[model samples]
Target: MTLLTYRTQARWAVAVVNSKKATAEFYDVETNKRIPRTAWTADMKAFAAEKAANVPKPPFVFRLTIIGWIVVALLAAGFGVMTYETLKPTEQSAEQVAMEQTPVVGDMYFGRFEGAAEPDSLVAISDLGFGWFKIVKVEGDTYFVAKSTDMSKQHQPKEQLESAEFEEEGTPAKIVEQTGWQLTLEAIDESVTFYVTDKK
Candidate 1:
């Protein structure tokens, strides 16, 4: 009796054979099955050859010289510094920080005045109609707001309203000055339904 080995795509297989009879009992390691010779295919020979060609070589042995070690250390240090810089918090400009914390001069607040009439018109504030107030001037805790023209039945105003040049069209009919305390009070007032700020 003789023992022989071959490989398939799945795993290595072994055969116990009677040398004189040229007959063998084949066993597949992966499937744990006894493979019949009639079931073998031409692909098996190709798989075995491929498995032999692709046998994993021993792990590569590396011997770093002093210069190589120094280069690797420098690269590691550079990578660490890059990672820290990527993760660190970035500082915001003074203007940017102020804009995020509080409303800026160009910011506009859009809302409807429940019972108030439109400027120079008898039309009362309606559900379909809305108005906005622009922050025309700001002086230490006091925001001077200029009321926009009663935007008709349209709730959405044009994009031009966002520009500072829009304020130059005509003199504002009413300018309401309010401190932070008064502004907070307005938020709870029943007359003023909603005030949405648009910051530039």
Candidate 2:
């Protein structure tokens, strides 16, 4: 025994079929009314086959619409990622870090040593201050740099000295040696170098 119930509002049809018997029935929409039994004999099978032949196949519109929506959604997602990458800033890289780690060095040298023929030289540069100086002169082969807190405005090699004028009255200033401090940074020019000595 087989029965089918059609609910017009729901646009649904439920069928109960007896696969072995090949028997079926159709029902009305309201009042649970029984319509009639449909026998699956030779004639009925032939008629159903003819009806199926006349009925058109499912249209391509529904499948195409689903595919089009999926494509659009994927494109939207890709575009969102690209927009985020363009609008958002990138993080600093190790190379950038390395560059930033370098500092701008400033230096100067002066005075003389026991073995050196010329007055010794002291050179120092730092990112902390803007300053300039030069080597007034050199007579010997070797040179050493020193630092001083108070350098004369007109002093040629205006180095911040560790020790004052040599005992010889022309020995010049000298360095503090191991006491030298340093700094590092990255400049706009993309160069990374360090100031070998910095004032505390």
Candidate 3:
């Protein structure tokens, strides 16, 4: 037996059908009334089909509004910025490079070093206060000229030292030996950090 209910303005009409016996019964919800079992009428079946066909169908596609487009555009812009930052060359100041790493010739840097506490001493550009300096000249293992822009008080004199040597004691410092004209300082000083640049 299958029972199908159809709704009217203020009541429900339930059509209970017995398929094996080819009979059906009509029940009224508002009056609590039922008709005696009988053969399925053509009008009743047509009414049921019409009601089934009138049901609202789901939309075929989802639509996005102006705000949705704006959201999508914003997300795209954000992703582009993040990608550019990831792939873009890092910005390094002359002083910041010197503080974190070894001193590179031809390139200038600024920062403080441990051993060169005194003024007018043979101090490496890697050692000093936060400032800018350039390895203006390099002469073998003994001498080098550096121009210092003192940003701190009592700046080290910008001049050439005849006999330059690495600082002794504290952390073992790894100074990059400029074997050729191309100065590559790959020294790693975990204790002292620095930054570098191509300009003085």
Q: Which one wins on lDDT?
A: 1
TM-scores, all candidates, are 0.29, 0.22, 0.30
Put down candidate 3 lDDT per residue, 1-200, tens digits, no spaces.
Answer: 34344332211132222222122346666666764446547777676566556644433223445666677789999999999999999876654454444444554543333323234546553353434445544444322324343344444433322123322222223445432122323224333432323223
- lDDT, candidate 1, at 141: 52
* Residue 4, candidate 1: alpha-carbon lDDT: 36
Q: Candidate 2: misplaced stretches above 4 Å?
A: 1-39, 57-96, 99-200
What's the true lDDT of residue 83 in model 3?
Answer: 100
Q: Could you give candidate 2's per-residue lDDT for residues 16-113 as a string of tens digits? A: 22222222333456656655435356665565456545544433212324556677789999999999999998786553443333221222323221
Q: Total clashing residue pairs per candidate?
A: 0, 29, 17
Off by over 4 Å in 1: 10-128, 136-146, 156-200
Task: Please report, in order, the local distance difference test score of every candidate based on alpha carbons.
Answer: 0.46, 0.35, 0.42
For model 1, state the Cα shift of residue 137 in Å. Answer: 5.6
> After TM-score superposition, what is the CA distance of residue 187 in candidate 3 from its true location, in Å?
13
lDDT string for model 1 (1-200, tens) is: 11234332211122222222122344677776777758666776555455545555423323455666677799999999999999999876654443345544666655433434456765665344345656666665544455566454545554633333334332222223333222221322233333433333
Model 1: lDDT of residue 34: 72
Distance from true position, residue 60, model 2, in Å? Answer: 3.6
Candidate 3 global TM-score: 0.30
